[model samples]
Target chain A: MYDDRKYTEENMPKTGILLEVENTELKDINFGLVTAARDTGANEVLAFTTEELGTEAQNDLARYGVSQLIRLRTDSADITSSPDNCAAACVQAAREYGLEYCLGLATAFGRDIFARMAALLDVELAADVLQIDFKAKTAVKSHFSGKTMATVSLQETPGLLTVRPNAISPVEQPATLESSVFQADIQSQAKVAVKEIKTSDDRKMDLTEAPIIITGGRPIGKPENYAMLQECADVLGGAVGASRAAVDAGYAPHSMQVGQTGKTVSPNLYLACGVSGAVQHFAGMKTSKVIVGINKDKDAPIFEKCDYGIVGDMFEVVPALTKALQQEKQG
Target chain B: MQIYVCLKHVPDTAANITLKGQADYEAGAVKFVANPYDEYAVEEAVQLVEKDGSGEVVLVTLGPSEAVTTLRSSLAMGATRGLLVKTDEKFCDSKTTARALHAAILQDGSPDLIFTGKVAVDTEGSQTPYRLARLFDLPVANEVSALAINDGSAVAERELGAGNREVLEMKTPCVIGTTKGLNEPRYPKFPDIMKAKKKEIKELALADLDPALDPRPNLGKLEPVPERSGATMMEGSVEESVAQLIRTLKEGKML
Candidate 1:
């Protein structure tokens, strides 16, 4: 029941979804892509990238019989790194193939680049889509705004969508991946230029690339306590994270928030300390390799979701846990 | 370096989601205003040109012709000019709206920079800016908390999860969608308001741009969220309230 006009065979790929392979060494190419394709019906299917996990990542997609592997070949040296250019390349490929849908990782670049691409194509973009259903000539994506899931539909053709990275599971097998070269017409009246590139760490760990994450929430009480989370992250050799509530309340900066309005992460280990598990917050980190919740409230939602749960005062629990970890290291 | 700031006339953030028969709220009844996050983006564009003192700042919006009210507001806040991509009210989704902007930007020629809010308050779906960047194949920075431009280059600080930050550098002809922390947007002044009336405000349509591209994902069921019961004010001190709140969160499995 998908729109016949939008899903026409001429647009074989539908929308050309964009994914950037950044710091391949720090990440696994094993992407958990969720897409609503015309050939596959409306059921959300998984896809993979070739950057992080490499050819092995495609093996994971193979399991999803419906999965299609899109190997984005970038002139490694000419990488723009800007989301705008990355999106442009994707759009060009999509348009060239007459695809009706474009997808992207709901990462930092995904948010910034998709806005401009949607504007350029004059299409409404569904951001951080967690669930997508296509039926009766419409594509619906469920997302969270303030409190609840806001299901949006694209009534138009050639729509753009971005999903949180870990929202969908990566298929463990490969599909018949169609290969094509999408070379951007760099001379096409580009509105932006890359003047320079700078990284916070000449070799600093990327939050998304980290194996372990320690996210704090409003329960941290004050901004000063953020250092405590840092202390724990230091012990774990992980990156620090935050929830949107903590950021909006000024307990920490917005970049640190990890929720529906913030960043989605899937580290090998995610330690949510003093974080009250709001649905929005949970939506972002639900796919972590392993979860550990430390909250005084024994009934915390995180306890149900996490593999390990510790109910106690965080101020007392954190220092003791740090000391214990330190002792483990010393011993 | 001519700059364009796209603005959306949206509902205020404080507006509560009212329910209808425990299923859906009447979105039509919601009051709409210029999106707050977009205000910061518009402010950044205007401020960038003003601070640079060598470029023009133009504001753009794609709503009903009445969107002129929003466009004029941008002019009043020091935009050099404004463009209205007029369309029927029902075509307010990101795709059609973005087309109108692309048309206006194309007609206006290549601007050195484009700016928009991270997401519209009314729609609350943050994806248009990136799409536009892809279409134009321009560089972009989103949710930028801080920015600086000099000569033909610009620098921005992007907020990452957990007190983390990334600094980006881009050439001109970039797009920046901002969050609230970028800067405090200025209100309209009488002098500026008078000048805004005299500034040019052009109106165009989807047809005026390239043929309208087909839209993906048609919306089906529109329903409102269920209302929560009235919150109980805890008659206790901070310590007690924290404990009680923790208990309630635990009971709800939210803690």
Candidate 2:
């Protein structure tokens, strides 16, 4: 273990990306993935949490050419996430390393937790940044202000940014590196306790990170009929999305809803089934490379935003699309 | 019970916004109001305090003096008090606004619960409540549609995707970001509106809070949403339109 006292300011490398793992297993996964995504820049990639990085995650990180992994241990295993603790830790880390930027995954937990860190640091929290131009020293496209794209630069030290999950394609490279574990200064019990962990059984993937999304609106009519859209998503390896109108109308859950009021997504492919393509709904997913709209109303606003329009009953079209996917997969 | 509801004044949702030159559209010829979503937050706090039968609800805002309108609107909804932290235009962003709020909340002592809308229509940040929860070291439930305060804890149903729902039980001193389904925010009654005129609104300057936040996105330049072309009507029977649609879909390779 590197002594906190012995590690002086001059020797510490600049620019480290930190990730908190859900468990020791996830810690491994995060380090592995992060190391794989690392570049030739002279710096470090670290994962900090209650547990040490797993051997498998270390190996993965090595594959990606990461120089080393630093796992910071926490006192309690069941520490809850708080904006305060994260902010304090991040700010301390940034100030110590004289880092340029802090990067985080744009998960629901990250969005909630990192925004506070940005607030505490007195720097802007650039949410849902799709691409980071390291050479240009800029962040490209954050999710905010309704379906808009922006590139931001920070004159200040250690600007915080959250990366859209699928936006950065993870790559694998082989390397040889050592993994070191250290304890965090803040005790885990000092942080807020996560009261609960709830996972929806209906989805195989998280909506915010899904590469493909098939969404529906109130036009889908009944809640039970939503299964048809789910079938399409299942075949595409995507998650189901809903419009706020659909959620307010009792057709879907609020978590799945997307708009100015809900989650913003920029998947590779977005399919709107029975969604009228309201500006609010479009605002959430317009960044997608391809949009397909299936609506009975030929004049539905969604047709304008979509690359393809299916003027037909979503009920019939969705089943057929699912069947097509099944056939392609089978063949 | 002392309850505080955070409010923000925002551009009216109904305004026909146009893309003027580059940096933040020339925001002219548009109407503005207290953010519509925040109204629900204030209403929920007021209702919760009233349900308890003996409590005071306070409205707090970190913005310019113009934000007093938002505070007054909350008072008109039956809130007993108001606090406004006036600052430069920088407080317009959520991070700066949240820091200002943390300062105010710390000065005012602990609140049992903090409520905020899922996001403001102008800034459209759904992360502030979560961030605030972090700042206070409180548990948070984001985008909740329904909530029930129990003994020392609150049970809330959060909307998840694909018609899935998660009911999380959190302890007191927590933060919740409410969705539109929480309740129908009440319109200001006439009597309450008149009483709000006499309500004491404590206006604090930015200096008083010693704000500790950079109020910029710090990402890159802002760009406006592209304009939609005029609507096109398919002049044909439904079957003919479907044929044309299939043709369009195939041509676009969506088929």
Candidate 3:
């Protein structure tokens, strides 16, 4: 069955969603940007990727209502070699497509590219927004470490905005997919050259983008004990985190620390083990949809904020949960 | 070599931020300090000059008159001087801040390199370096965790999360927004502190900067984070609790 939209197809505003690829695989998060760009199911969505999208990536985005997928072409300059090159190329692609707004995830990669694009275009950027209101040309963003939320309007176009990853849920809206390539007329000076890229030893997803997070606090005795959380996180297809206490105590690196002093995360599920749920740690992850706390003390403050609580030793309880999740996964 | 570092005087992370009215926090109640992230930038710049053996590291900041104190604190960290762009507003969007900083940097002449924080702790608008770079037409990189300056070029390593590192080589006169793990900031010694108090800092009203535009309305509606209601705490044995947790997550389709 062919479905017709109430509005004229030619009259809809055009939006371009920049797809991110790592290790020759498209990040699953891009689909959410596609859903977000299809505001009210009328704005025509175009997906742009610096690299060629495989069949899997193409089908995934198309199911999210992406009407057009564009691969940027380059002559001598490699987009992967420089952020400036990618920014220049993407801005050119957006213009060639007549895109009213260019939207992307606010991941580390997206932030670098989109900010440059906004600067190159001389347009005010809405960076790291949590929600978008196309009708008013505005976005909602967190301020003061998530203590407050601010609404900002896009005052110009072709608009440049980056939505926080996972902030917008991906909706399956089927549309005929159109695939093509656009050669970017990049007038970019080669000021920056990429030397090398080294992946981490663990190579796990970043905490801010991980859908599920399993965090350990002071209780995990040694650095190696984080493996307990890691085992469970692996089963859940999530990332592991450490509280500020763990970092200060030299149990984990500052990169894995989750607190106002560390990374601010809003995951689908937050499993806190031995964490006290202090304001700083809480402030960093209070936006998580579901919080589950496990502590030895029945009255731990984490229980007050958690969606579920367990008064037990993490050494025993974590393994039990991991085993249970493993069986659940098998079943 | 001439190096410039951009600093911002922001509310301390520990300080409470209660709104005075709309878009304005209670200024008096919150203690202001050099943005902790910017401290990284200042430290990286000061270290660069120290390593070069012959160069000047200048600290540039935007804030009210009191912000000079923050600038001096950076100077005590071994910077040669300071440049303060005076503005009473507690907050300014990244665009205006970048424009003002661009103009202030030009006053000191074209810098060999510019450094700033990946994101200001207070406003957290992380686009200033890019915007400022555009105003200069130079290349820029943000969230760099490691860096080594070479002859008129720099090799910087930036964290892309998931433990991935992208090493880049940028030509001189570029902007860099540093993050944690770059370098440890040093606390100033007693004599250095006294000398920093006397360090030269040029002050200019943001208004005086080439007809700077008024602060844009970045905040249309500002309010506190919504209070979460009706938190649930599951009971019973460890296995039972885990089962209940799984059930709820599945029901919500968050699993």
* lDDT of candidate 1 over B1-255, digit per residue (tens): 688888886544445456454224545666666777788887888777777778888888877766787777778888888887766553255555665687788888778889998776555677567656666766667787888887777788776533456777777677788886798789888998998999999887756666664333334444443332222332243344444533543454422
- lDDT tens digits, residue span B1-255, model 2: 667777776666545555444435434455557777788788899898889998787777877677777678778988888888887562256666777787787787679888888777665455678667667778777767888888788877765443455666668878888776788889898998899999998888766677455455443466665645433333354455445544554565544
Interface RMSD of each: 8.2, 4.8, 1.8
lDDT of 1 by residue, A213-322 (tens): 78887888889998887787787677788887788788976656676556657666787888877766765676665666777787777776666656667786667656
True lDDT of residue A154, candidate 2: 46
- TM-score per candidate, chains pooled: 0.65, 0.79, 0.95
Identify the candidate with maximal TM-score: 3
Ranking of all predicted structures according to DockQ, beginning with the best and ending with the worst? 3, 2, 1
Off by over 4 Å in 3: A1-7
Candidate with the greatest DockQ versus the true structure: 3
DockQ of each: 0.19, 0.29, 0.65
Per-residue CA lDDT of candidate 3, range B65-105, in tens? Answer: 99888888889999999999888876676778888899999
The residue-by-residue lDDT of candidate 3 on A58-87, one tens digit each, is 888888899998888888577777778888
Query: In candidate 1 chain B, where is summed lDDT lowest over 10 consecutive residues?
Result: B226-235
Candidate 3 — which pairs collide?
none
Chain B of candidate 3 vs. true chain B, TM? 0.93
